[model samples]
Target: MQTITSARMAAIDTNCEYLGIKRLQLMENAGAAVASAVKERISSGKVVIIAGRGNNGGDAFVAARHLGGYDVTVILIGKKEDLKTPEALHNWNVLEKTSIPLVEFTNSTFFDPSILKNAKVIIDGIFGTGVRGRIHEPESTIIDLINGSGAFVLSVDVPSGFDPDGGEFDKAVHAGLTLTFHKMKTGFLSQNAQQYTGEIRVVDIGIPIEAEFYVGPGDIQPFLKRPAISHKGDAGRILVIGGGPYSGAPALSALSALRAGADIVTVAAPKNVSDIIASYSPNLIVKKLTGEILVEDDIPIISRLIEKHDVVVMGMGLGNADETLLAIEKIVPLCTKAVIDADALSPQLVPFLDKNMILTPHAGEMKRLSGNDVPDEQKERIEFIKSFAQKNEVTVLLKGAIDLISDWLEVRANRTGNAGMTVGGTGDVLAGLTGALFARCKSPLEAAACGAFINGAAGDMAFKEFGYGLLATDIIDYIPAVMKA
Candidate 1:
């Protein structure tokens, strides 16, 4: 009995496409389901469909084709050119080839109530999960007509003008039955929802369950569509703390953060390797620590920097020096949010674990931190990761051929990376990418899922061109492209 919000449902829809299921196929299944529901009410009659310009309308268009015996007529709320989605347009084109009478109401002035006057059944598809704000135009007029028609009303997905997420709407259609796709919407559980949605029916439209469980292109959209009015550092400000023994590790992380849409990134490393790390990218804001390596003395400066940045990407290559680990133990408690990785994945840091922290660990690192063997079987491994995350009170992003991400309650997997990603510095790229997403997303699980998908997808893209010779920097270069796609 899982209920999904409109936004999360939209993400799952996109993820389904990433997994090779096209939106048009789902629309066909939905239309077939709607047509079946109509047949249940009555075999054949004059059926009038009120459709908008989105996928909701597309579903209605599909239903019209299946409703062969009945006199099915489609009343489009807008012009065919005004269709919002390609799937909707495609269905409209298909409907045009058929004899299912099509009527277009370009404006409220042109809307004829007589079309619905004879409808023995009215299918409401004017709006679905995308409805927001007050009612307007031909939609408002059509909603009223549907509610007053006294016909046996069947709402497609959600009733028109109803807020599918918050269950708040200024004006909405009252339907005798609602055929919801995929799963039940959360808003339907709201008080007084039954008044509009008479009898609710959940329809399976061929969206694979893996689409919800796996991270894909869907997870990246919300973060990428930042406000145009946003200022500097609004996207994300990341602080990378690493680079005592190896300079390249921290540099890779800082650069990857920038490519992953972090507005600003500062790499704080030991003074000895600061110059080399800084030389890697002029775009990086390098902070020089007092000594040759991370020590207890640097805590004061690091603490202040953590306060300024949105999230901390720590432990790329500080080595296992007692003094360095001790410094990390103290620094972990100061940050509100962080991505702890590599040498920072020590058992000692577990005492400070919280929901705000994300630990990125390979199988070996996970074993060391959890004091348990990383299971060989996939199901056992997934359960182990979930148990470890729940016990530690932190999100775990376990790196492997199949990346597993979990935040106590739920687990997600990403299978985007290839064998070529076994190359060095790739994990550093993931750590930094996770930090950038962690700064923007409300859920640590979502941030970790998105990070794993984007990082691995970029590697897959780079592998296509460079094969096994792909470098971590090559993956970094493709980060923005993955986000854009």
Candidate 2:
């Protein structure tokens, strides 16, 4: 049996749309599935859908329209005008035309408790799988009413108030049957969720298998969590150790980190190019070192700085000198999470490489790291890279026409980039993007895969704007647009 976490499910849906599947069609299919599940449980009775003003409510509205044999009443948990998504609001408008009773959840006292008490089947669509934390307000009071009633509950997806990823919650719905879509969610199999989830049934809404296998704009789902009350440095505080012999490499990296949504980016560079790198962007926090290139002496201060940031991105234009390699060996291992690229991909740095580190290497750097020649053929290259990653127990992102990201056991191939991405500084942008994403993503492999996809997709977008004239900076310019899409 195949399964998907909430993040993966969302990514798959995004890919579905990217592949030309309409969002409204998926919603209709989801609603039809919910209605069928409800009908299977109850032959005929009064049905009450407790809906929130979101996609979840849209699903309920679709279900209400399909349940023609039952006496349906929609208890919208919020104002009808409050629906934020177009699909949800569209469904809400459609339900308004029908004769089914439409009630709004204005306050605790406004809704009739008898509606829930008299319901033979109550659809718990107050929240979808994305919801987290404590159940509050009218919904909190309504949750008590629903639980208090003898109604046969049919929850849309996981029960409302349940964290699909599995966690502690203030309150959660106890459903007799949970009609999950496409695949099972994050917490579906956990022992803590079994009682709350009830008899779980996976519904096929026709999301293609290719959606699951391919990397798309949806892969960035994990990086998009923005809480209303989030504090500073909540997104990511990235420390970049590079610069010197060449300045723009680290500058490109820091800017890439910033563009990829890292809250703060600090570049620690040599004296020769620290000012130059700093001048590239006022957004970058520059830490000036004593020498022209990385030396053994810089390790102590770099180690101290590493403690302050969430992820460290090392070796973008720090020339491949002997002292620089020594610096990389000393600095990379002390850091918690890192992206080792550019001049930092020396053989000596391999000992410091771990699962927490993402190594972005082209053919030459890959050959140097593994002492194995990379075959020109795609299949052989994948096998070689996969084997090397497994043997080293490190994440390897092989940069090429088709990027191959592997974390020993699992692998993902990203074909989003075009031939125009052969420009000089693009790899640095990719490394920075990966580090920025690495700070937020739970898995290093996921971050690397998303990094490759976004960088390549942005490159493709740039290619569309400017043919063979595509520059590395152009990819950087397109990062936000690609991510937003």
Candidate 3:
């Protein structure tokens, strides 16, 4: 079971050409799978297939044709003539010959609840992986109607109006089941998709196995699995530094690292907070640093401590100061695998970065590091981050509405995490998770990507129970659940 982003899936579609498979054949298989699943679930239900203008709608069209014997109505949600794909148009032409009632909606006024009042099952094909931005007015209204219909809504591919890679959705269809073809879309497992998607079943459409090698979840699972004969030291050791004014931040990171499968976690903080951190978790080994504020003189002791751990998580709650920045600049160069995050991120520390380091920065942190604001548009931000990561020779996990991870070798997006994760300490947890992964992963880039995905997914699971009131501790509690999923 592999999960891929919408853009990566699109790349796979193109790669299929090399295998002598046309896009139409894939769509046909996808539609057949959806139809088969529907038939198996509800044989006598009146199926309402709500299709859009994209290839996803084409898949629904194919399902409509296969299930034409049943009471099925095909509702096209866009200008029928504007469909871009030849395969989609072909399916549309085939639908015209069927007796299944077909309706078109060019504008918001066309959304009529009466059309779907008799539907026992609704097939959502309104939008697919490529959809971004807020769903338009009529579409939003239509989605709301389908959600409130009390009918079993089966989504074709991914739920329409949801970002397949990652990010919050303005509007999306709530599905009882999501029938995804070939592989699971990354969005289906992301934070935003949880509300809209349920019981995601990946249907094999016979995509070549070799095609998977080109793009997929690139080696992130090693960190999730435990070794059979692993001892405490074998699981990986993590050292977390930072904690003066904001003591809980480093503690949160240390706890998350432990939850993420790190066997040994050590926290090196000011003496005032060392006992406070140790009291939270018995697993933590606290080292009290004798300093009012971290300075360049602390680098020698930090360098010695780095030798005792596999990876170091730094910068959480470390107040931004010239002295702190100087200490980070000196310490980061000495450490092999380090997560430079929070207040530790500064232009002064860039020269110390190497491929072994992971820089976890939010939008504001990224702006400070790069001296340019990340644009609201996801694609633009992804490109900018990729360029920046490649230039710096370090993996950059740019935390935003959609987390984008980039190293010189590859770029990936993690669309996990709910609105509830906006609270403080979550970022600290993310840094801790990354540090733990870095201990097991082959490279810093792989650790950073997996860390973001797992951290955000854990947040999504926490949101199920806690909803809007979720805290960072809730996310840590759900870490195992996300890994099991």
TM-score of every model versus the real structure:
0.97, 0.84, 0.58
lDDT, candidate 1, 1-485, per-residue tens: 77999988999999999889999999999999999999998987899988899999999999999999998999888789999999999999999999888988886446767888878899998998988998987677778888889899999999888788755689999989999998999989888998888899999999998999888788778977887699999999999999999999999999999998899999999999999999998899999999988999999899899989999999998999999999999999998999999999999999998999999999999999989999989899999998988888999999999999998688899999999999999999999999999889878899988999999999999999999999999999999999984
The local lDDT score (0 to 100) that residue 356 gets in candidate 1 is 94
Cα lDDT, model 3, residue 242? 87
Q: For residues 1-485, what per-residue lDDT tens digits would candidate 3 score against the true structure? A: 46787755775676576457788999999999889888988868688998888899999999999895689999888767978688999999998887888887878445768878878899998888888897886678888899999899999988887777777768788898998877778767666566688888888887886454322233344554675777877878999998876789999999999988888999888777778889998988888877755777777777789999999999988898787778888888788889989989998988888888899999999989999988889769878988898898989998976788889566777767878899988999999998988898677776887788788878988898999999999999988776662
State the weakest 10-residue window (summed lDDT) of model 1: 104-113
lDDT per residue, candidate 2, 55-79, as tens digits?
A: 8888989999999979899988878
Best by lDDT: 1
Clashing residue pairs, backbone N/CA/C < 3 A, model 2: none
Q: Is candidate 2 or candidate 3 better by lDDT?
A: 2
Once superposed on the true structure, which residue ranges of model 1 sit more than 4 Å away at CA? none
Error (Å) of candidate 2 at residue 460 is 3.2
Off by over 4 Å in 2: 1-8, 99-101, 108-110, 116-119, 221-237, 243-247, 261-301, 304-310, 319-327, 373-386, 440-442, 480-485
Measured over all alpha carbons after superposition, the RMSD of each candidate to the real structure, in angstroms, is 1.5, 3.6, 17.4
